[model samples]
Target: MSTLEIRDLHVSVDTETGPKEILRGVDLTVSSGQTHAIMGPNGSGKSTLAYSLAGHPKYTVTSGTVTLDGEDVLAMSVDERARAGLFLAMQYPVEVPGVSVSNFLRTAKTAVDGESPKLRTWVKDVKNSMQSLAIDDAFAERDLNTGFSGGEKKRHEILQLELLKPKFAVLDETDSGLDIDALRVVSDGVNRFTADGDKGVMLITHYTRILRYIKPDHVHVFIAGRVAEEGGPELADKLEEHGYVDYAGASA
Candidate 1:
């Protein structure tokens, strides 16, 4: 089984004044067949940790080590990270004006696998995935995320997750804007991806709503860029009842 390890990770971002530190010494490990839920208040470095792992240029790793199966993840470029089996589903997916969803998915799959998928099987797979996600057939012909609703964008992200089948996925606030119905659809998609017990997930969210649909093996409470508590699914139930107030004050 593959493992993704983050050790004493410290990241920062440049601002108007200067470099502002975000993640201050955080550590976590996710192995295959495990799902870890990261819960925290706003500005607690949840997204920073996600982006840092995906090798976003905006966030700089000042000090830390991120390894995938013992290979240095921090050393690889963004695309190289994808090829290494890491995927990130952004909270707010950006629009790609000129790229059609069909073309985009095919291109990404080719890049990740180092070879193009056969036309016949690729077409059938894309069609089946889209139908399962309740996505319209015409969506494949539409430009990626252009004029798409929040739910549409999020669904498309999961579509990629389904097709590419990454070793680990960092889902950053994927449930933020989805309604109850859309939420169920999206959550089901994630469940299908992990049902095989071979994929790992780092689900970042502010609420326990999604956790109801996607059960995590471990729950971590992030306070001030550090994990304040770790437990089983019971921890999520506590968060729902007590919220992060107690943890916030302690971290202060």
Candidate 2:
């Protein structure tokens, strides 16, 4: 099984004042076949951790080591990381005005797999995945995420997950803005991806609702950019009842 390890990760971002630290010496590990839930309140550096793992230029890794199966992830370029089996489904998926969803998915799949898929098989696979996600056939011809509803955008993100089949997926608040039906559809798609027990998932969110659908093997409570407490599914229940108020002092 593959492993993604994070050790003493400290990240900072440039503000109008200066570079401000967000993640403060955080550490975690996610192995294939496990789903890790990172829960926290707003401004608690949860998204920072997600973007950092994806090597977003806005967040600089001042000191840390992120590795995927003993390979240096911090050193790899953004696309290189994806090719190495790292995928990030952004909370706010960006709009690619001119790129058709069909073309974008094909391009991304080719880039990750190092070869283009056979046209016939690729078409069939895309059609099936889209159908499973309840996406309309016309969506494949539309511009990627352009003018789509929040639920539509999120569903499209899962579409990419199904097609790309990355070793690890970091989903940043995927449950946000999703209605009950859409949530179930998206959660089911994630379940399908991890059903083989060979994929790792880092699900970052503020609520425990998604946990009901996609159970996590470990639940990490993030406070002030660090892990304040961690437990099994039980911890998510606690957060749902108590919220992050108990961990408020960590930031001070």
Q: Which stretches of candidate 1 lie over 4 Å from their true place?
A: none
Instruction: State the lDDT of candidate 2 residue by residue for 164-197, as single tens digits.
Output: 9999999999999999999999999999999999
RMSD of 1: 0.8
For candidate 1, the per-residue lDDT at 188 reads 97
TM-score to native of every candidate shown: 0.99, 0.99
Clashes of 2: 0
What does candidate 1 score on TM? 0.99
lDDT of each: 0.95, 0.95
Ten-residue stretch with the least lDDT total in model 2? 243-252
What TM-score quantifies how close candidate 2 is to the native fold?
Answer: 0.99
